[model samples]
Target chain A: MTKRIQQFLNEQKPATPCVVIDLDVIKNNYGSMRTHLPLAQVFYAVKANPAPEVVNLLVNEGSSFDVASVPEVDLCLSQGANPDNISFGNTIKKEPHIAYAYSKGIRLFAFDSEEELLKISRAAPGSKVYCRILVENEGAQWPLSRKFGCEVEMAEDLLCQARELGLVPYGVSFHVGSQQTDLSQWDVAMTRVASLFMTLQERGIELTAINLGGGFPAHYIEHVEEMPAYADAVMRAIVGHFGNRLPKLMIEPGRSMVGDSGVLQAEVVLVSRKSNDDCKRWVYLDAGKFNGLAETLDEAITYRVTTSRDGEETEPVILAGPTCDSVDVIYEKKEYSLPLGLKAGDLVQFHSTGAYTTSYASVNFNGFEPIKAYCI
Target chain B: MTKRIQQFLNEQKPATPCVVIDLDVIKNNYGSMRTHLPLAQVFYAVKANPAPEVVNLLVNEGSSFDVASVPEVDLCLSQGANPDNISFGNTIKKEPHIAYAYSKGIRLFAFDSEEELLKISRAAPGSKVYCRILVENEGAQWPLSRKFGCEVEMAEDLLCQARELGLVPYGVSFHVGSQQTDLSQWDVAMTRVASLFMTLQERGIELTAINLGGGFPAHYIEHVEEMPAYADAVMRAIVGHFGNRLPKLMIEPGRSMVGDSGVLQAEVVLVSRKSNDDCKRWVYLDAGKFNGLAETLDEAITYRVTTSRDGEETEPVILAGPTCDSVDVIYEKKEYSLPLGLKAGDLVQFHSTGAYTTSYASVNFNGFEPIKAYCI
Candidate 1:
């Protein structure tokens, strides 16, 4: 275990499962990002970990926000973030939510469809709008399907239509997919953005900015390239694609910024063999898919788990959450080894789980309390 | 559209996505279960839908509760349910929770492990304990994995241990799996329970009650046999296996009791083709996996979706939720047909969504509001 996790465990001594976020690590992560990409501005994706403390820390570090909804805009604004620095990143939004964000003085927004652009025109007139281009998210840890962006033809039409409807055709944005590991994915997305930029330039529209939506990978169970390596690859790609005429660039880093700053501490509810003849042992934890770790869906993100009982003989076990729901098993097919002496009341820590842990927690499924977060 | 749904849409005119529950349907479903299984006591599983109105209505009907946690016990007690009618159904529980339930005058509980039995003995001494026996959940609509229950030998050992630990070895319980459609699955499970009962009796511990844990099916896209058919099948299987020496019988119904009583109304955010050359259309709704319809995990439960503009020309479309996440796609592999006229601001209703909808909702994911429910 890292010193940060050990210190947190020693201090908090949590009886119930809780997420501990180290703000100092977040600050260091922010500094590292700024040091690597000197020209690019950082807009922390608020949806990843919307804890007010996380937002406030980023705000103190002079980070902008890429908000998805009216409440996200409000969360950033409430934490003293400037509304001018916030962008509505979600393409599919309710009209009233658009108006609500507009009422709160958020001018920049993202849209993919003509209907959405029309709603933006009506709700927030003359606002800065970015059209997202659909990209292949192959090899991404969490491969996003066709959900947010439109095709190149649709993007071109949507941008031109935005100008016709009295909205500023501000820029282009694209997400390579969350927990994106491969650096070449950024090159592919940036090349597409560059092509769209030139197409729009030929159409006599001068775009002012390029919003690089969040896809930065976090170190979980697997090793990823360092932050500076990703930053170097991104900067080199942008320069190679756009050369000297790069638009005012911004990168929204959700998982990369916060994933390593927190650790989730959950206690073992029980450890038993299902049957005497059964091969594997079952270790059940107090926290599960519903309470905090909903990102464990389909085992997309594999978090490294460690128990307080260390340096003993280890055995492969099927990890499960403390719920009557059978689907709540966290790890079964995958081989997860834990100390053989692990039993009930032992603390188990899931490392590098800050980003998607608490934000996706359900309030009361199977009557378990939502995962609580404590910031240090 | 069903008259129940049409009346709801016409009457409520919900501007945002909401769950509409018909109390009359719930009352009728409860009455049907009682009529079909006259000998079995009803313990409505609170985790299905923890809506206060549902609990209070069931309380008025004198229904017992199979609660998973202390808050569930408190919810029942606060709703004026008698302590004797509530069973602490979850085997995985914290020590404080057991003590709290005991302090609240709850005596019936379930356990499947030695550690749990020890905790109960220390906290809630002499409580009526049930040991859940593990069985193959074959052919069930939602086949549960090995997250809950233990094997026959484990159950026998645990029950015997419960008596030695100063607890009442009261009964045996087993879940055939949620949304169970196969009647023969129950026969196999009950036969195992009978064997365990006889073994426990040989050890001088008389097991009085038998908890036929929740598995009852609900009508969704596929047709299920009515309540009487299920009850009759269950009765026949019990008589065939137990041979008239049935213990004090109880049935915990979660989905079947309330599933058909509710309808979820969500407005279409947008309807568009992925590209000009693409064949199928994509229909987006305000509610998705994170908010209310979490039962869509792995497409285990296929809900029937309809819109107010029914009977119009229809086309196969991909359905998705409003969140920015890619995994939020509700239907992609499956072919779901919707009206071609479906557009922004049009209302779509998902039928038979009363159970497991709102209770599993996250508080705020991508800043969307947690799904709200209303009762009539």
Candidate 2:
């Protein structure tokens, strides 16, 4: 556990099975991003955490927001973020939501489909729009298959359609994938964005910005390159690809910004072996995929787990969430070792889980309360 | 689409991306189960749907409930269900929850661990307890894994311990698995239960009930044998395994009881091909994993999807939920054919989604509202 988390736990002794976020850590993370990418504007992805405190902290830090829906726009706006600084980032949106965002004076938006572009044109006439191009998401811990982006050719057509439909064809964007580890992936994605920018430029549509969607990774179980290293790689690639013709660079960092800042203190509900000769021990925690930690789906985001009991004989165990549903097992295939003497009431602190944990919590499953989050 | 759903849509024209539950279907399902298993009492698994209307209907029909938490117990009580008829079925529970349930006059409880037994003993002393035995969940669509239940020897020990702790050793229960297809799996599970029952009887503990637990499959992609056939098979297995002397039989049916009774009407946000040569069309729905239909995690539940444009030329498409997250792609690996002309404003109805759909909905992700459910 980090010293900060230990200190918080020692001081507060918060009820088990709650998310504790350190605002100071978040401030440091935001500062690092600003220092590393001086040329790039940071837009915090609200869907990752969406905690009021996290949003307010980022807003106070002079950061913008990448919002997906009308409520998100409302949240950012309520947090004192300027509407101009918020981008309606979701490509698939309801017409009413589009109109609501427009009514709120939020002009920046993203779309990958012609229909979506048309919807935006009708709902928010002449709004600034960015088309997202689909790219191969290789080496990403959480690979985004074909959910958001359109093909390069289709993106070009969509941008042309946007301009013809009276919507401003302002920029291009693409996500390398969430929790993306390979920095070279940005080089490939930026090259594609630059090529698209040049293509649009030839067609007399001068783009003003390039929205680099959220993918920056957080250090969890695996060692990841620091923010400065990612920034250097991104800057070098932009200069190599776009030269002096660089548009306003923008980045949406969800996980990297808040992931390491939050710690989940979950209590061990039970620990037992199914059979006497069974090799694996089962450790059940109060929270699970339904309550929170839904990112554990397929074990895509491996959270580094630490128990209060340390330096004891360790054994690989199957970590499961406390729910009636059998599918709530968190770590069964993956090898996760914990102290053999671990028992109920022992605090197991999951590190760097601020992002994607609380936001994905279901309201009630098997009657368990949603994972409570506390911002310190 | 089913005539009932079409009629409901044409008449009510409810907002898209909502769950429509057919209470008549639930009534018929409950009646059928009661008729088929005359000896077995039906405890409707509230976690499956938990919709107030569904619970009230079940309560009015004099059905029991298998609840997992205090809130579930409260829901049942609020719905006018007798507390004696509701069993606290979740094996892993907090002490406070046990105390709360006990204070509410709930007596029947289930546990699989010594720590849990102790908690129950302190909280709900002298409560009727059932020990679940871990069984091989082979041929199950949604396998339980090692999340619930313990070994046969351990179960016997636990039951004995429950008696020593002044709790009534009420029964033995086992779940064959969710969406279980093979009926023979129940026979195997019952045999194990019978053996344990005999062992417990020899040790001066008479088990009163046998909870077959929830496994009873719902009609999804495959045709399922009717409730009568399942009840018949279970009766024969019980008769064959235990001869003339039989315990009071009970079943907790979650998916099968309510799965087929619900229909989800989701609007197509957009449909497009990623590339010219791309073989599959991508169809985006307004509701997704975050909003509801989370059972699509690994495509465990294959929902039968229908569109308003039925009878039009059909094409295999990659179905996805509307979200900015790339992992929101629903059926990329599995082949799903949809109307070739499906577009925005078209309605796509997912059948047999009544059970797990609304209950698993997240409060808010990407600003999408939880899938609302209406009972008709």
Tens-place lDDT digits, model 2, residues B1-376: 4578769889999997898888988998999999889889999999999988899999999999999887899999999999999999998887888899999999999998788899999999999999888987887888887788989998999899999999999999999888877888889998899999899889999999999998888888867787877888899989988889989999999998999888888898877676656788888889888777798878778888888898999989999998887778777777889888888889988889888888788878776778888888
What level of docking quality does candidate 2 show? medium
Give the per-residue lDDT of model 1 (tens digit) for B1-376.
3476568768868756788888888888888888899889999999998888999999999899999888899999999999999999988888888999999999999988778889999999989999887888887888988778889988998888898988999999999988888888888898898888888888898998889998898898887878887898889888987787778889999999999888888889878775667788888899999889898877788999888788999989989999888888888877898888888899888889999999788878888888888887
lDDT of each residue in A242-305, candidate 2, tens digit only? 8887789999999999999888989998887776677998999998888778888888888998
With a 3 Å backbone cut-off (N, CA, C), the pairs that clash in candidate 2 are none
What lDDT tens digits, residue by residue, belong to model 1 across residues A104-158?
8899999887788889999999999998889988768898888878898889888
TM-score of 2: 0.96
| Model 2 / residue A256 / CA error / Å | 0.9
Error of 1 at A99 (Å): 2.2
**Angstrom error at residue B88, model 1:** 0.8
